[model samples]
Target: MAHKLTRLVPVFAVDDIERLCAFYEKSLGFVQDFRYGEPTYYVGLVKDVVEIHLISTSSPNARQPWGSGYLSLLVDQVDDLYRRLKGFDAEIVVLPDEGITAYAIL
Candidate 1:
């Protein structure tokens, strides 16, 4: 028997979990599944999939260096998604082009 890799959910160290959650919800359209007090921790779902878990970086253990990891998402229309995210207060870490995709650090 062989085991197969199924899914991967990236956890982000965010300074403000609520802000991060709002960014994902407004910018990326991910829905909130659950959250803790002070909105320090939260789980978001997209298309019924648990795509991201936002955790507060106030704790010493939660803080980590930015640009230390990468998250790859497969979507039906990348251009449409990019357009939708344009209104949000997010930094364009990378812009999409031939053979490359855009990246935003929100």
Candidate 2:
């Protein structure tokens, strides 16, 4: 017998879970899947087959150091997504090239 892997969901620690979830919805086209806590200390977002989880924390060190981690999303239209990200004022650390793209919501 062999085990099968179905999915991988990355959880992010943020100072403002509500704000970050909103950004993922409005900016990246992700929909709200679920949320925990009255003040929304945790959230789950889904876009296509991908899912992301966010947890709120006031600690300044909640998130990993810059460049220490990243999330990669594969979109059908790389150029279109890049343009949309730029319009949304996302923190794009790398420009799209050769059918590949990368950006951040920070």
Candidate 3:
């Protein structure tokens, strides 16, 4: 039998854990699942069964260590989610194009 893949959870390194957590909780409706660290350097969030992990980094003012990556979320209503996010001040790089099935934010 072929190997079976289960759920996927993406981890992102952020400068500020609290700020990112706030964004995910308030903006995306994710709930805080767990946290760690003295100054709170690690965090986990969940929406439904999907999990997102975040790690705080205090690196100098340089380029991110991770070259490039992005997360793609498939929602029931993409247009509604897009409209809801429009009220906030997030950088939307890719809007739903003719060939694209989802919008992207950076």
Candidate 4:
């Protein structure tokens, strides 16, 4: 018998979940699924099959860094997704063959 894994939801640290959730919804096409806290400090988002969670770092454990992340998301239709993302204000760059190969090698 073999164990199985289900889903991998990445939690993004943020000082303001409202703003971050808005960005994810607007820029990345993710929809808000649920939230937690009085002012909604923690929120969950879903885009197609992929889900993302955002947690606020404004608590007593404020040592957590805010708004700093590096993620490589694997998605279908890379070119179309790239074009859609390019319309946003985010910095978009196309990786050449060497750059992509580097990821593959890793």
Candidate 5:
């Protein structure tokens, strides 16, 4: 059978899933799509394209490492995102160097 790649949603194992969900919603402008058990399990949507799943650290399959990877988001205005994130305490792992090109490591 031919392997076909569909969509990729990063599942983040967080100590506090609810707090993480709130951070994404408040900081990254993501809307709550669906949540289970008071945000213990949650799916958030941003721009109707990107999806982020937040899972609690206590979940059954929670302790697995995400493996080394990077997801790059291409935006016309990185500065705007940078400013917005700064207000929400999102760590700027990489700062844009003179080209208005920056990255948010999550």
Candidate 6:
């Protein structure tokens, strides 16, 4: 017998869990699904079919290096999302016409 895999969730190690959650909610429109730990050591967010998890980290060095830990999201309206992110003052690493890729830090 073979085991079947279910959903896949990407976890981001962030220095500030609350900030990351707020960013996803405010910038990307992802809703907060759940949060764990008294100090919020873990969080889950969902938007459409995509789900993202975040974990609080005390050490910044524990986080992935710059340009790494990238997550690719597929949206219904690429242009609309691009504009929303830009409107939020997000860092647009790649232009929409050039294959949309954005990174924002709060």
In model 6, residue pairs whose N, Cα or C atoms come closer than 3 Å (at least 3 residues apart or on different chains), thus clashing, are: none
For 1-106, candidate 5 gives per-residue lDDT tens digits of: 9999898887777788877777778876788887776535545556458887777877776667857556576676778888988888877788888775867655
Q: How many collisions per candidate? A: 0, 0, 0, 0, 0, 0
Which pairs of residues collide in model 4? none
Q: Write the per-residue lDDT of candidate 1 for residues 6-82, one digit (tens) a residue.
A: 98777877777777677778877788777765535544556456577766777555657755876666776877777
Task: Give the C-alpha miss distance for residue 36 in model 1, angstroms.
Answer: 1.7
Candidate 4: global Cα-lDDT? 0.70
> How does residue 38 of candidate 1 score in lDDT?
51
Q: How close is candidate 5 to the true structure, as a TM-score?
A: 0.77
Highest-scoring model, TM-score: 3
RMSD of each: 3.1, 3.3, 3.6, 5.0, 2.5, 3.7
Ranking by TM-score: 3, 2, 6, 5, 1, 4
Q: Taking the tens digit of each residue's C-alpha lDDT, what string does model 4 give over 3-104?
A: 788988887777778877877798778898998888676789998888888888875533565556565767767666566656765555544364352121
Better of 1 and 5 by lDDT: 5
Mark the 10 consecutive residues where model 5 has the least summed lDDT: 38-47
TM-score of 1: 0.72
lDDT (tens digit, per residue) of candidate 6 on 30-100:
99999887767888999998999888886433465477667888657777777787788887775644563
Rank by lDDT, descending?
3, 2, 6, 5, 4, 1
Instruction: Report the Cα lDDT for residue 3, model 3.
Output: 82
The lDDT of each candidate is 0.69, 0.78, 0.81, 0.70, 0.73, 0.77
Estimated TM-score per prediction?
0.72, 0.80, 0.82, 0.68, 0.77, 0.79
Distance from true position, residue 56, model 5, in Å?
Answer: 0.7
Candidate 3 regions off by >4 Å?
Answer: 1-6, 59-66
Predicted candidate 3 versus true structure: per-residue lDDT over 1-106, tens digit per residue: 9989897788888887898898888878999999876778778899987899988776332246647778877788788788777867778888888867688886
Tell me how far the alpha carbon of residue 98 in candidate 4 is from the true structure, in angstroms, after superposition. 6.4
